[model samples]
Target: MAIPKYHELRISALRLLSDGRSMKLRDFLEPLANEFKLTDEEINEMYPSGNGHIFYDRISWALSYLNMAGLLDKPARGIYKISKKGVTMFNSETPEYINEFVDKEVAKRDKIKKNKNPEIKIIDLNDRQTPQEGLYTSFNNIRNSIYEEILTTILTKTPAAFEKLVVMLLQKMGYGGEIKNSGVVTKQSNDGGIDGIIKEDILGFGRINIQAKRYRLDIAVGREEIQRFVGALAVAQSNKGVFITTSYFSKGAIEYVENLFGNTTVVLIDGKNLASYIYDYGLGMQVEQTIEIKKMDTDFWDSMANQ
Candidate 1:
């Protein structure tokens, strides 16, 4: 069976502590996995960022929500026990109960904020995703929309502008040291297949050749195109090359570069990755706003209590 969503884990987690036994947060993993009959693969599935186990993360969020809603009590660090309210909730509440509680809590907090400052706005909550998850999802969505806009804007520019942009992006990424004229876009004519070059040092002892293709989104840069770029690298006597395109590469093109046996190395940057790099490196983009998410500092409170 598919792994249960974090919200779905709420009632099950409450049920686990319904017997009045205190369990460390880690202790809940095994029994919950067993109760859900989750496969080993499902239990160990990871987030896209590969930071932590997905199932374990969901479980932690479930416990946190229960604790916040006054259904669970934390008597010691990393340990949790069901409260009298939790036992009552386990017997009476349905799976959807946590969502209603969270919405009400958010409304209450917003109400308090509005009383202090009349301009305060109520926050919208997604029943299926925790706040952190929703924030990341919204961030990714905005970034993806910007990527489409970036590609469309790039396509509107001349081919020479695209070549210069690629070179500038590499320079911004610190490919070349701080040296004047370290990166240059070659003249349109008699430049061979290479469109740009980056001198890796002040003396121009090492260099990286660049080939930028401003192709339509539907176009796929094929093996022959990559071969020509490699040949251009050979002519320039440079062993490193970057083949960037506003379109994706064909399977054969990718495999050809992968299986090459020599000092020459080529890196392919496709449309999606190209846009992401531009956004990440702050190339031709500006930060319009910044939002900071803050959490309680438990250690500060612990130190104060001891003092």
Candidate 2:
């Protein structure tokens, strides 16, 4: 099932904590996941940032909002319990009361700020996000879901296929002059750590060395692997290389490339970045739909004001 929205999570959390017993964050995750009827695959689903599970992240946000609104309290690290106010509202069968209480609290806080500093503008805390901010957040969530799907599909392909895909993506980004002569995958026997190569022009004045690593998502590409690719580049006398991996690179590997000082140029594309590029270049993806968000034309309105 799709993850629940923040309000839904908030209500769920209050129901779970209504017993007045504290619960660890980890303990709360599974019950919530089960309550939502999330399958194992859905439970393991990650945020596009690769930072945490999507369900867990949303629950955490819900907890944060509730705590700020005084509906929940953290008695200790990683532990959360319902506040007296939280229990009262949960027992009253009026979920909307929590919202009203939060709004009243915000107004009280704003009034205090205004009284303390007469010249200071008191912003309405209850109206935190503008319409534009809400729209952008929704757009980003949709975009991230697409990126995650792209990565999952790519992981199922063979290494050779992944290499070809990297080449195709680069071509779509305008790497080579034409599609027919843009790039080619090398024979395995003589590849020398290079999976493919892309010519920058018809005359081949510049070329980009490509090394595509179809790695396990949990593992990382280290500096040693990068060093091997660098050796291969040195053998070919090429100063430009692109190392694309379906996993992340270690800090050491990233630092090594940054310190090159123009000796050689290596562009690293991890799984997250590769998905971003694929989406940006419209490679292997179609236009699902278009959303247009329009704003007022201030210039036109100002011209009308002059009349």
Candidate 3:
């Protein structure tokens, strides 16, 4: 069965912490998951955004809402305990009443925020997004948030780290011919803008030059940069080049690569595409869950009826 809605998750979380013990979020998740009798497959299911497991994500959101309502206390990051109010609610009423309590609390907070800023809007946090379209929109929003975090984390790493990440990704995509000597980062001179070299085959009959740019997400890679990389490829007498950046390329830059009708081939990869590759190849990310959706087989049913 599917996990409960957001408010229900809040109720479950509070009941689990009613003993007044400060529980780590990681530890609390186990019992909460067990209470629902969720299979390992169900627990591992991921959201469409591929950022996190759906079960864990919903549980985290429930904890956030409960904290906002003053029913839960966070003594430290990822560690939560039930508040006096939460204990009272647990003892006096059914978990369903927590929904009403949370609604009032959220409304009060939104009203306070609205007084300070008229532009702010308060939305109904429960049961409004039940349809498929609403579900997709919500999933996309979560995915976008995750993408922002990935870019921010990438910015904090060294340029060499980014280079190594790209190499690892290409190798996973089957670009590096063999395990040993598949690719090497040219540290000695920037090699006229080339950061690394990848061999196409084990025999080294062909090679590809790689230029990695750790540009800020807001910045755009221009045609001039691509041209310089092309010149570097020429200097090295290589016909293949890959120009990758943690930012997007301008229209002119893309057109330049498309119109360059010669032996040289330059493939451009931007920030969004880069992150997608990282996710797909599991380079820096891990599998949180795998979910499978089953559809009815009309042909099999029809055959049974005919029989």
Candidate 4:
């Protein structure tokens, strides 16, 4: 069976977690996988392009999501019990108890947990204008926030969700890219490496091939992976590649790219850089404010003086 969406997986976990018993992520996920009829092979097919532990991270995300949605209260790494919300959610006798409950029933959660009266931020009406520059500033700020969210999401999200986000972002950036289900394995991966591909430009015009490595910590994409990516570029008869990751590259990997820049013009974006770019571009985020500025036409002014 095809990989389930992240939300779907979360809902499944929630329904099971709805029971009074404390459960582990694996406990809820494995049986849910069975109920969903996903074989190990099928399940393995869900990680993002370059990640190896897609399932494990995704399970983590499911648990985190339930906790945020006010359903399950996790006491530790592997243990979870139904919250007041969860227990009530389980008692529903409707056809669509899960999705419906989260949507209409669960109200928007407060950003911060507090029992005191909430303090709202007040903007100076005079300073906060909807002019051109103001608008641009607001828009950029919101976009950056979303990029941060997406990066954070990918850091612990399902491979399926990561892939969807990659596709969406690439498309927004006008990259002629495709997310092939290579089961998140790489040719350089003596164990398992590489992820998705982004063909940004046409062959002659130049193409940007992407290697997105979603990591949890500082893992250097060393000479081996860089070398393999180079080989892949050669196979495709292309000259440019991007090695992106949610971690730092080893010194060897950095030096290797420096050595090869004359040829492939490879670009490396570690997790921090990747997150910043997404923020700057406003991929999955919404625009907040718009601003405009006006200046006199210098040429016209000059002509008037001459006249």
Candidate 5:
């Protein structure tokens, strides 16, 4: 497997817990390694695929959700047990279909809450928000902005520099992209689209090849461009190519890339991806300043209200 999709990891965690052992996250993770045939370090290195760790967070939320909804139960903190509800679910399912089950439970919870609450749940828009909500919004916005900056930065740099920037950006997002923004990579003379490669796990080493392109948003990459990149991969006898572009791929371009070959494979990354990489890595963000500040002073507030 190139990378185990994070939802798979969540389901794996639950299946491990269902073993009737009181397990910590550490314990739960071991079976995942055995199942995936990976080491502990590999599990630690696998980052979430989308929305940063929110996908993993969603998985964690799903676990709690299953427990709360009575599909699973907790015997203790850090220990989860499959309830009768869970057993019924397990017997009727296959591993590939677990996500559907989690989604079902999530829906079930929403329906139950609606029946009991009846009134609209109080949700304040961020314009008038709770401290927790405000913090989440602020951080997420900062992360989004950083991704845009990275794409734009690449657009402005030389193609030679784009490869290094992409690696640095990946490292910033927390992927193990070992890149010195300036070295001649493995097939430096002959390889076409490939910049330096990034391997999240040694398992992914031969399975992945990454190509970087820097362009203005208006420039649309077409299928021929993708085909050329794929040909470069073939020269290296590689299985996959990731074409990362700062501009969008034409719809025809996307369809053409996917259908380009039966055994050959390529993944297209356009402007949207360029931004996501930045956000995923927390790229271009540094702590500029911080201050210890007082929260609302009760007396000051009271005086203002009286006046």
Candidate 6:
């Protein structure tokens, strides 16, 4: 079954705490998984950031929202119990009604804070996405825009520049050891299908051949082109190759590489993936700003309380 939304988990959380038992955040995982009948895979599914399980993150957000709405009480660090308001709301309100109430309550608190501190920005909680989800969505949208810009910029550069860029990207990806001149872009003329090469070691025993294509967005690298590259690898007597393009590969091209039998291994990086790699490796890009998201240290608070 699909994981329940954070708002959907609100009533269930209240129901769990209705008996006046204090529960830790971890205590909710099994009961909530059982309540939703989530499969093992679903329970273990991770957020795109890979920091935590998506299900667990959503449950934490649900509890936080409930606390913000005065529906739950945190009597101790990392511990939660349904308050009188929460029990009353759970018994009397539908899920949708409770969600709307939470939104209104949060907005009211924001209004009160805004009256005291004009610098505090208010958020619109009407959207189904939680604040964290909204932040990630915004981040992805910005990254996609930058990816398009990177492709457009690369398409305008000369073929040699594109080859050099690919070589630099591979080096940034740790293709070569901390040795200078480990990666080299071959000359355009008299060069085989390979555009660049990276020495994987100091002794130049292992190498990764590169074939970079500065193709138009509408063009696709086809099976014939891949076969030609394989033939070129055979001539070079090298089995490892990377074919990067400012376009995509045809289905036949991908299938041909996938079904290849031998020691030869070719990795394909299309325009989208190429741009993503460039971004990830911080090639041809600089950090304009960094935002840090901070959270409460509940364990530290618990330690202080014990003292």
Each model's total of backbone clashes: 0, 0, 1, 14, 2, 0
> Please, what is the TM-score per model?
0.59, 0.58, 0.59, 0.41, 0.43, 0.58
Shift in Å, residue 157, candidate 6: 0.4
Error of 6 at 93 (Å): 51
Estimate, for each residue in 77-126, the C-alpha lDDT of model 1 and write its tens digit. Answer: 57899998888867787657756875466457547645844633333454
Every candidate's CA RMSD: 21.0, 13.2, 10.0, 16.4, 23.0, 20.8
211-264 per-residue lDDT for model 4 (tens digits): 677776445677888889888777767687777777778889889888874567
Better of 4 and 5 by TM-score: 5
| Model 3 per-residue lDDT tens digits across residues 1-307 | 7776666688878878889988876775689888988888888888666867888878887887888899998775567999998888889987667888887897787687568447443444464765654655555545544665577678878999988877777877788756577887888354578888888877776888899999998799999999999999999999999998988999999999999977999999988778767776777787755545466899888778553
Candidate 6: 10-residue stretch with minimal lDDT:
116-125
- Segments of candidate 2 deviating more than 4 angstroms: 1-128, 305-307
Q: Please list the residue runs of candidate 6 whose C-alpha ends up more than 4 Å from where it truly belongs after superposition.
A: 1-126, 304-307
Alpha carbon lDDT of each predicted model: 0.85, 0.81, 0.80, 0.62, 0.63, 0.88
Ranked by lDDT, the better of candidates 1 and 4 is 1
Q: 1 or 2: which has the higher lDDT?
A: 1
Worst 10 residues of 2 by lDDT: 116-125
**Where does the lowest 10-residue lDDT sum fall in candidate 4?**
113-122
Model 1 scores a C-alpha lDDT of 0.85
Record all residue pairs in model 2 with backbone atoms less than 3 Å apart, i.e. clashing.
Answer: none
Backbone clashes in model 1, listed as residue pairs? none
What TM-score number comes out for model 6?
Answer: 0.58
**What TM-score number comes out for model 3?**
0.59
Global lDDT for candidate 4?
0.62
Per-residue lDDT of 1-307 in model 5, one digit per residue for the tens? 3335555665666666665655554454445557778655554553333233333344455566566556677665546677876777666777556666776766676566447446423233536877766766656545544555566556667776777766666556555545333222335475566785655554554445677777787799887887787787888678766778898898888898767756787877777667776655556555543434357888877878453
